[model samples]
Target: MYTPPAFRIDDRQRLVATIRDAGLATLVTATVEGLMATPLPLLLDETEGPHGTLYGHLARANPQGRLPAIGGEALAMFSGPDAYVTPAFYATKQETGRVVPTWNYVAVHAYGTLELFDDPDRLLNLVRRLTERHEASRPMPWSVADAPEDFIRAQLRGIVGLRLQISRIEGKCKASQNRPAADREGVAAGLAASDRPADREMAALVAAAPP
Candidate 1:
């Protein structure tokens, strides 16, 4: 996360919002063999610790979960809207023609200590909460109890739950913050006109950023 001063997102609320909206995140850990990462849809408990805590699970047989981590320190990466910014979209390109292509995006890095578990009860609770969280928007929401008790218990046995007590949180919004105001505006307008959904999302973020 080599973020320039201008592109740094210091707003805690905004960072949390970005992570929540992203829904899924990548969890990275330093292992004896190097780095290991897992893409997961983790639940965030904003009230859990200093910054917050992350909750998720891995398959019981997943070797990644058994590896020793760097004193439990792990990084969860949440990525938001992203768009490719072409030099042609910047107003500066029309003047000095010195602009180059770059990516405008939002991301959050949550550093924490990861605690893994194989407890059936806790894993069941985690799965229930995760299901409810995602299914809340549905007209007919599903529940963990929907399945047979024995089957549900069997399923829980095959997975391991994890809780990450977040210690540090860093957010970055590389949305043309370093560009001239006019250039930023032009990029936003260009992105808004693009067919890509991600571009349109980035356009709104750029427009909302302070000039």
Candidate 2:
């Protein structure tokens, strides 16, 4: 991910949390036909591997599931809160007018060999878990049992399951940590005052990041 020393995140716990919080990832793989990427939500099993294992599915029509990963590995990229930082948010802007705009963001990259499966039972379980995870916050949560059995089976048949056992993971949090305390504070304050939810989330990360 070309992370500088100050931006590197080696803490597995934090990396896992970031992945979970992002809720979706872009899966990238090498193929004979070239590289293919799919933006999908993946369920992470932190207990499954040295890093973690990811589970998800895509339409049967997506060739990404059928193609062979030339390197026998794939990458899942997760992006967290991010905000644009303007030079006006820096103390240096007033002192020397030397600052430029930059972005404050959090991201994680996971690499692993992918394993595809079509077993109805496992796919059913995967969909159920994925559904529950996303619906837990709802006033009335829905379940796989809410649908007709035959219809659910038919739906599952049209998709293929993906499992990636993570071999390596990397995280980067570019949150204005390289800036001075005053500049960082200014940046955080600017982002926090913004109306966008993403900017507010990024403000918290920037405020909490150690310089």
Candidate 3:
């Protein structure tokens, strides 16, 4: 991520919050064939390591799990709220006519060593945690125990679990922080007025961020 100094997000707590909110991530790996990527809902085990561990599973036949060993590193991307900031939304652009369209968003890039299918128990635990995290949004939440043991074990056989011990994390928060206060406020108002839910959510994030 090419992040300017003003747009860099160095706060660990804020970066973690953005990652958690993203829920899903893109995992990329290089191979002899080429680069392979998978968009997956991952379980972030913040308690496990120095920067914490990332857990996820892919189908046993998925190519990524079979490829990463050829390469030593992998990257996981977590994206938060984002919106298009139009020039019309900036007060400075209206006044000086110098501003151009840009995007306002938050994203985290995690680089780590690949630890694929380390242990069966650890894999099961990862699944449990991921299920609980997503189920938290439901009225009547479900659990891994809800399924029969044989069925659960059978299902697990078709997937390969993974662990990525994150060595580096880069966070970028491009939320109009480089703009003048007045222009930022104008952009926020414009995003808030949009019918799209994502734009409205991004507006709130920008409004809450420090100037």
Candidate 4:
């Protein structure tokens, strides 16, 4: 994450919020064979460690769980709202024709050591927690207990649990913070009018950015 000072997000609470909101993360590890990455929906336990702890599961067939990670460190990347910022959206471009296209986005990178386990009890609990988190907002929420016990137990056997004890976190929010106030306002307006949900989400972030 090559973040300039203007775009850096160092607030611990904000970083944790971003991670939790992003929901999905790319888990990357440097293995002896090569680098391996898996996209997963992870749960962040902020009280579990200094930075936090990430919990997820990998398919039993996924080799990433079996590989020896380099230095025992892994990186989990979470990407939030993002949108393409066209030059047409920059007021400076019209004034001086000096501005070009850019991207506005938010992201967080968590570094931690890899911990893999297959204990049935722990895996079951992890699945239940993850399920509850995602289903909490639904009108008709579902639960692990809704399924048959033998079936759920068998399903858990096909996955391996992953735990990352986070050591550090890096966050970046490139929401036109480097642009002039007028240009940033233009960007926010442009994004707000766009049809893409991602664009609309970024519009709010751009509007909230410091001038």
lDDT of 3 by residue, 1-211 (tens): 8988888989989888888989899999888879889999877778977887888999888988777655588889999888999999888976899988898888999988888883667767878889999999999999999999888877888889988888999999888887788988998899999999889988887787677
Report lDDT (CA) for all predictions. Answer: 0.91, 0.93, 0.86, 0.95
Ordering by lDDT? 4, 2, 1, 3
Question: What lDDT, from 0 to 1, does candidate 1 have?
Answer: 0.91
- Candidate 1: residue pairs that collide: none
- Residues 43-119, model 4: lDDT tens digits: 99988989989999999999998997899999999999999999999889889999889999999999999999999
TM-score for all models, in order of appearance: 0.96, 0.97, 0.94, 0.98
Tell me model 4's lDDT, rounded to 2 decimals: 0.95
Least accurate 10 contiguous residues by lDDT in model 1: 63-72
Off by over 4 Å in 1: none
Error of 4 at 208 (Å): 1.2
Order of candidates by TM-score, top first? 4, 2, 1, 3
lDDT of 1 by residue, 11-79 (tens): 889988998898899989999888999999999999998788999998878776888687879999999
User: How much is the lDDT of residue 174 in candidate 3?
Assistant: 85
Cα RMSD of all models vs. native, in order, equals: 1.1, 0.9, 1.6, 0.8
- Residue 189, candidate 1: Cα error in Å is 0.7
lDDT of 2 by residue, 26-95 (tens): 9999999999999999999888988879999989999998988887899999999989999999999999
Q: lDDT, candidate 1, residue 111?
A: 93
